[model samples]
Target: MKLQVTGSISELLTGISHLSEELNFTIGSDGYPISVVKRPGPIEVKNANGQGEICFEKKIHFYRALGLWLQNFEKSKEFHIVEHPQFETSGVMIDASRNAVLTTDGIQMLLRKMAVMGLNLAMLYTEDTYEVPEYPYFGYMRGRYSEIEIKICDDYAEELGIEMIPCIQTLAHLKEALKWNYSNEFRDTESILLAGEPKTYEFLRTIIKSATKPYRSNRIHIGMDEAHELGLGKYLELNGYHNRFEIMNQHLKQVIHITEDLDLKPMIWSDMYFRLASKVGNYYDKDATIPEEIIKMIPNVQMVYWDYYHTEESHYEKMLTMHKLLVDEPIFAGGLWTWNGIAPNYGKAFRTTEAALKANKKFGIKEVFATMWGDNGAETPIQTVLPGMQLYAEYTYHQEVGPEHLAERFEFCTGYHLEDFLLLNHFDETPGVMKDNLYESNPSKFLLWQDILIGLYDKNIEGFPIAQHYEKLIQPLHDAKGKNHDMNLLFHFYEELARVLSVKAELGINLKNAYDQADKDAVHACSEKLSSLRKDVEKLRLAHKKLWFSTNKPFGWEVLDIRYGGLLTRIHSAEERVQEWLDDPTVRIEELEAERLFYNGIYTFGEEGTLGRNLYHRIVSNSVFSD
Candidate 1:
């Protein structure tokens, strides 16, 4: 076990002796926080009851701190953690608004983990979930949460010393409720703004009112980020509103008004502020990113600066620029590393967290959130992210050493090999084939590439559709037609196939140019990158097979569709053909892309060819504007 302490000279020495007996290590004191290092030794104590204090960078030491309390249990009762002067607070925002819906069970499970980490704040970004009972149909299909379910989650969170902050995507991504065509508030205007109306302000007000009524937290995150498709043809035609910045600002002000009226403090995504900040360096151009309106108006409101890939030096640097820009308000947000259902990207997570701690000290960011997004619905379990979150909780709360020193502590807390644990716990499990590709490409790059590829795959959700469509096309290649061809599945397959192919092309180019000119370190890194990429491809193939084979006969859906699974599997020879490319990335990539084009060709045989029943229904149902 190792522990590093920082602070006043006296406090540092005192803290060391306080834990000397329990930690079974010797503390070599250096003047600064970075100087103190813990080494294994016989338990020793001297002058611990002094005026100075110490903090630990290693979590096992922190765990040992808690274990000290546990070990001194009187009879049958003891506290899991010793009470400290500073209370731990965590803020999380789950984007359930985007087609992904987290179940009540998932919410309960998340709250339980948050409490363990001493997280005191939680937010569920719901567009359709937790609709106001008075306006029952407001959210419709997209808004699936009931007030009862929300209250249940809310009550549990409160009990755990965590406040549940409900996040609502008021303006954009409101297509779920808009499709119902249930509101006439701004029905006449083109639906560019959001919620089926050009007048997005009013829609936001209604949502705010509904959410704030039951929840008591004054801080609410009104997600005004990613309004990319703003002020198009209709919005432009209505009043010559070509200026997106002006329009975005107007919408933000309107939302702010609603928040004020509700007697609540608003927390909006700080992308707009960061957008306006100086490009920091040549890598970022002001024109390519968010509008400047954010930087100008952010001081007036509380802001959350969110970036999940903080481990990347570039991202951390940008965050510093943003903090400098917004020298006002209680600025608090986290560097995100893991999201979606893929494994947690630990390398990025660890790098980002370490950066955040240094960042927190440098920029004075008071609060942070480690985001776990449900991008592709609840296809993967929320519990999968807990281990990674625990690592962050330790890093964020207990800070005494550098990033390298915390690594050993991480292995002890998680009970898994550091590399394998990071790869398995935080990244997508590379299917056997991906590993094979790396071994074939460059044996030296085997370990690093495998690990890196897992993280990349976790972030990418293309495997789901790639697997689904390939199965569809292969199932009845000779006989399938029209309605049987799932357009949604095919479109996703094409998109993902393109992305994967693009990455492969990029990798090939890098290998060709860099291999000859690279230094030893560069070559080793590149080899590892290639290996990881291969593993990602392998996992993609496996995911494809899993989805394709289960389309009709989903494992747990026997009660809902008894014949669906059987019918899907019955497509003679589909399974066998897919299995053939399971061991080959090149073949897997080629066949999937070919199948995507084939599916596209089948649908677009002629310019105005009559559409199949399935396509027809999808087109019509998806075309109309809703409330």
Candidate 2:
């Protein structure tokens, strides 16, 4: 079908159609391409004289074409898709409830980003970001959205062919409002309700009324996720209330009523709807699933199926099932593919988005939303994923970007864009450094090495299992106890190993300097430094070898199952080993003391001797012990 060429919509689609032959779809006057349900009967294409009902039992080609077209359009020069289209809805939800209230300029920037990605909807979840004078808390940043700011953002979104849907928390994620001392009316209890008193219908009504005043968009998203204390003691105290589901439904229905009164269609997270679905029949003998009850109670209401880990295979299946249930109602599949890092997980996000698109076709899902969650903190640098989001727009709208094209785009998106940003790991700068090595190691020394590398990276090193492998190395050292006569060997082993590592650090700086200098002498100096560092590393290796010789076979046969000891017993073993060393008569007490001090040093001062007390004092203690 040929799109009626008019305004930005025409330009956007025209640029898209130019990129591929399969992007033959047309945007109607209603704002987007009219998605007809694929069936086995006869069909007609507008102006093209094409007629036939296309049966899509498994029309993978057609679905793929649609996804490819989206991907192409995103990469086109006229516009960009800011987020991966398939993973998330073209809908953006901002948590204005938090401290980062939406500034007018920020909202505009978001709109530009969304428009470039072909997004059509936005959900501004606010406690009091925008306020209206009549409503007292509408558009509540300090008071609410001034009529002008609200009009500006809304109109701007409309101009970009996007809709702004205001969101207010009916149940939870309403800390700001509660902090405003307005929670006693809504929160059922203090502990259960963080920012307010207790959850009730009245407070929800006020929030809804306050939030939905400015927007022309009929749709609204009433957030009800993360309500840990769903039913407070007083709520459960109700004579007939047996479960939390009934209480939630009652509050939900009230929200629906409020939305209806405002002539607005309400949308909500499917989480509460799913959680309370089982309890609905038990609570009030009513259909509780939002999709199931759509035609009955709130026919006009839409549901968003949001999954942050959309890259997981299971999540793709879950969304498909959810789409089937919510077929008639507008189901927006929301996916999250970026977090905690500066770069987006392009590979995972792409795969997830592809799955979502495929599912959209399979389960008749019409809308998609890409979500950015502020979980770690606001300083998470979400802007890092903007390029990836744009790539999503491209891939979803258009099928492909060759290596060279993607590389150029990446450079545009990220200042230092490489060719395969999607395939690259986050810390691509450093090589062979794995995470997860710190905790699992038994002796704690090898784990200490992993910790040193992590400090250099200055990033979250929590998930890496590098320490587990280091644990294997620890076993040999631990087993070597009682095999050696010279206790001084162990002391020197650690001290020299540390000194060698320090030399490696110095050599690293010298190598960098040599590269900058680009002179023959500088090159020679770099080579010398590298050679010296290598020798030091060899020395460290020799020290470790000696340590192994002293310890390995002595206690090798005392094999005990660590699991049988439990966590506490395992911890006690380390302390016991230290005690055993202290108690040994043949060992020089001073040398044992010196090693103990070094062990402590390893803990406090990293492998590089950064952050520790004076080494002089520790040596003095050793000398005193020896004398």
Q: Whole-model lDDT for model 1 versus the true structure?
A: 0.44
Candidate 2 residues 95-199, lDDT tens each? 444333445765775665555444566677664565634445333434245657777888766655567888766666655455545445444444334222334
lDDT of 1 at 366: 62
Reference-based TM-score of each model? 0.56, 0.51
Evaluate all candidate structures by whole-model CA lDDT and list the values in order: 0.44, 0.43
1-627 per-residue lDDT for model 1 (tens digits)? 333444323423433353344334454553212222243421111112221221333222332333332232322232223223122345566656544456665576566545434455678877666676556676555536767777777766655456888787655555555555554454323333432244556666777777766676787877766555566545555656455556666767777777888888887775644343336422234333444544565435666666654344455555556455554634455534334222334444555556665665455556667676644223323434555566555555555445453444433333223333332221222322232121111111111121221121211222223223223332232222122232223223223333333344233223323333433454344455544444445544444334333321122222212222222232122233333333332333222222111112232222221111112112111224244
Residue 529 displacement (Å), model 1: 30
The Cα error of candidate 2 at residue 25, in Å, is: 27
Candidate 1: regions farther than 4 A off: 1-68, 71-88, 98-100, 183-199, 273-299, 312-318, 330-332, 335-342, 400-627
How far off is model 1, as Cα RMSD?
Answer: 15.8
